[model samples]
Target: MALLDFLRQKEFAEISALKNKLALLEKDIEIFREREDRLNHDILSLRNERDKLLKYKDVSDVDNEKERIIKELKDAKEELQKEELESKDNIEKLKKEAEELLEEIENKKKQVVELDNTILLQDYGMYSPVYDFADSEMYKDRLDAIRTEQKNMILYKTAATCSTNWTLNGSEAQGRVMTNQNIKQILRCFNDECDMLISKVKFNNATAFIEKIRKSYDALNKMNSKNAVSISYEYLELKVQELQLAYEYAQKKQEEKEEQRRIREQMREEARLQKEIEEARKDIEKEQKHYMNALLKLDKQLGECDEVEKEVLLEKKSEIERHLSDLDIAIKDIDYREANKRAGYVYIISNIGSFGENVYKIGMTRRLDPMERVDELGDASVPFKFDVHAMIFSDDAPTLETALHHAFENKKVNMINGRREFFNVTLEEIEEVVKANYDKTVEFVQIPQAEQYRESQKILKSLEIS
Candidate 1:
């Protein structure tokens, strides 16, 4: 219905209306995509160029000379005994610094791909694929045999997007073992708003969802997950009770001190001998003084943790709400299958670095559209018209997709289909990444075997409950 309505809302006749708007956005996406490709080319070229440019001036080859110098340095150091130490001491700092700088530069170069990918995603949303898909329905009726032609058909309508209700409550998807910080990062994706919003989704593909998880984890590894994870509300509530109790104690002490001060002031003028202080009065006063001091000290002690506690929980209701909102957004359904297309061959590729036979090349694209993806990544995506390495499709379509699963990780999550629901990744997320990344490979290896029956029987005889 949204697809139909959206198409109706647009005026296809106008050049600069909705259609134009979508087209322009696509154009922009294309430019970024092309730019990304150019940048990648530049990076590759620079990598090769740097290798050649490592020559030191006046030396035949800086690398060779350095090797010679290193050998001589090693021999001389052996002779001096302390030479090795001096060499290590002299170069370790420099080596460490060089490595760090190199990493920084590599990060900078790679950033172009990241930003370009983001831009491509924005483009998909602008030119939503819903309309395109809806326009692809091919009409058909009873067909004819070779002997007698039955009928002919050439009607077309667009495809439909799958829909689901929004009854997302945070607790259902609540994950365990996730830290407070991990949850916050996932929450940020939902708009950085301070409110709890939770939504459930039906993912299209489990593999794609896992891919998303891998990507998200890599992006937010340094972020703290503890904050987002819900501690025992019971425990926190208990802590609150403790806080309130301390607060009460402090207030009572403060009041008691005030009263004692008044009493002491009232008795100040009378001479020590003339005013024979009642033993009871003195005892009461002494008790009041001792308690007052103790209370003050306790107040300060509790005060020490005030900020830390507040931060841990301040507007926590609000924080949890914000996290829920993030979850809702993270679980949005891309459902690329809904998109209708005019295509020759389509290859949806993930990290193909390790899948050699399954992979054509290690290529990266900043765009999601097959056409723009082709233009951006160059030959790998569309090496030759008919020779498409692997025709593939992705679950995320119309709108660009990102890996929020990785962004959230194993705090607690239920990945239904290709969508993430019920939990945040605030725990040992990397392990989850590795687990998910190779999920496919692992599944193939772990399938139960027929020979395992004999092995199982032997194990049972050894000490098993058969």
Candidate 2:
């Protein structure tokens, strides 16, 4: 009887300790969950920043600095792998430790149940042992832990999942956010001082617990929350490289756009100045035409006038002098007006594929954003505004424009090559045309897998080497 009573007291203490540890574990799970949420948000933001940056840079240009980028990528990869291995290994260790503790707790619970059945018996008899069993709340605690165990396990699995996803994205910001959640769980799991983790531990624990309850009992019966953790880690690692590369490209593109904008402003100023010069030239031509007309009139009057006295002739000379003075003033006025009235300036993309310069683009489009459309088609980058400027050269502008169009027709518009002729332009002309007409660069989408395979087969057939 004494032995049974002593065992009950001892069991009570064990149960209390388990409860405390369980609380801590629950807290730890919550920390991880919060961290996971933070990581997800960070990952998405970084992805956006990365995507926006990509719209401006060329893959070919960035490839020149591949060596430097590769090194950075290598370092990031190693760090991520190290963290994943450590966190995962520790989780497994804790799980093993928990299993051993669970066995001990279960043994104690069985003893308490046996003691409960005897509490109704006589004093100093089986009845007294029954009272002891009922008194110790170990049985209640064991049931609670059992119910909660599944939940706790689930929470840990969830934390692992969230943590791994952030890690895989390879963004420092994302990883940091997750780490904040992880710190609390780490403390609970191994106990640490991550501020974010500390705050989230409880919330994570409850969430994980509830999720477990929602799962199928049969599925839960097969114990492997660690498997879920392991899977999450593997998936994250696979995606990290891709995400980082996307970010790098995006950053490069934004810088390119700023440069393009600066060039555009410069072009606008040049066009304005050219417009002024053209207007002045036109005014000079007009004045020259009027002066010639006045000179012809003076000659006609001199030839027709009859011979008269010297005084009369001198007066006529004075009259002609006055008219000459008036004409000079008219010319001056015309020059002044010409100086202020500016002509419209035109810029055209040029030097496309000519041998000694003076080459220009040749393409036709009804839309104003002809060059912009080329960019969407992923054709070529328009280098300068002058390069892409529109012009109407003749009374038959559309017919003469065929020279330009014939220069740039791709002959292939869609991904597949159908017998349908796309255009009648040379390759060189197309490159020039797009450069002269558009500000954005082109980037073609990847061909679908089935099409690629078919293309490969056709190539082999042509070579007779497949």
Candidate 3:
């Protein structure tokens, strides 16, 4: 029994140890579960931190993209500013060029205007005197010399040109004959054209005629171009000069004719004045003799009369003495007029019917009665009477008239002929010139009483109305 109890205790001890080992193993399992839960929590926190880091990186990338866009915009702005400045400079250059072109065009227009003015002046017969001469005679002498030179040129065969060694059929003599004939024909044609144009040249057509001559020369040369025929330059220039000389000569002749007419009129006027003075002197002498005879008769009556009759005879003798004194004064005045040949009246007159307003004729007359000359001028020569603006008696009337003419030379009615006494000027302008030239106070009739002209105008108006 004792042995059975010992074995049973040993078995019990073994079973208890087995149970203790199983308990320890359960504690270790619980520790391990706690450790695993802690580890899972740590892993989840790390994962959340990694997600935060990735979000930060995405924000940085967006900022970098924005900076890049701003840099690109800045670069584009700088380029645009540069282009703007260059465009402005180009615009300024173009504007300057346009202004310069406008200025150049204005200068060209002014030059054209000046040329037109010159051409107009030439057309008005106001040539710039190509040849200066003392008189028509001098011009004639110059023309003769020119003709002699031309004749010499023609005689020397220098007036025309042609191929000197021209040949026909290889014969030198035949070629010479042909060349001579051709030269003669060409010269004759050219000379005839120049002569026709020159003869027809006047002041108005002189430029056109010269151009025609030049054209004719060119045409003839062109027509005979193969032959190489042409007029000499010197000969052509001589012909042109002859044309100008002929025109000037014609003008000079007209001036000479007018001058001769003036001289003849002056002589006639002087003769008339002399005859009138002589007649007046004879009349004065005859009147003085009659008065003296009456005085003698009255004196004899006074010597043989009663008191009342003697008183009457004495009064009559006194009247005759007064008449003789007046006659003697008249004779002295006549003598003074006869001695002073330059003494005359300068008259300013206007014929409104024949000439328009602002037109006046200034003239001088040596007549004792200046009105007589005025009346003669207002006769059949004019449609209406001349209204006298002023009649000034001057010791040197010719000088006064000439001075007035020179003062108003540009205002003359006939610009070509200076002998024309008519002037286109206002009355005030004339008065001012008169005051400047004349030392004495000159009374001018400011308003012209064109009675005949005004009356005729009224009558014409009435006729039109009727």
Index of the highest-TM-score prediction: 3
lDDT for 366 in candidate 1 is 17
Estimated TM-score for each candidate: 0.17, 0.22, 0.70
Overall lDDT per candidate, in order of appearance? 0.34, 0.42, 0.77
* 1 versus 3: better TM-score goes to: 3
* Positional deviation of residue 447's Cα in model 3 after best superposition, in angstroms: 3.1
| Deviation in Å, model 3, residue 47 alpha carbon | 64
Question: Model 2, residue 153: displacement in angstroms?
Answer: 18
How many residue pairs in model 3 have overlapping backbones?
0
Tell me the lDDT of model 1 at 206: 20
Write one digit per residue (lDDT tens) for candidate 2, span 238-260.
22222222223333344456567
Expressed as tens digits, the lDDT of each residue in 272-323 for candidate 1 is 2123223424554565566456555545555576776645444543444555
lDDT of 3 by residue, 1-466 (tens): 2432453465455545545554554455455445545545554554565455446554646576555555554555455455545545655554565455455545433322111334535666545568878689988998888888988988999998895588899998998888888889988988987887677666676765665567667778778878878888898888888888888887787878989999999999999899989999999999999999888888888888999888878888888999999999999988988999988999999987899899999889998889989899889978999999999888898999899889999899988777678999988888898888794598999888989899999999999999
What are the runs in model 3 whose C-alpha is more than 4 Å off?
A: 1-122, 435-441
Which window of ten consecutive residues has the lowest lDDT sum in model 3? 108-117
Deviation from truth (RMSD, Å), model 3: 38.3
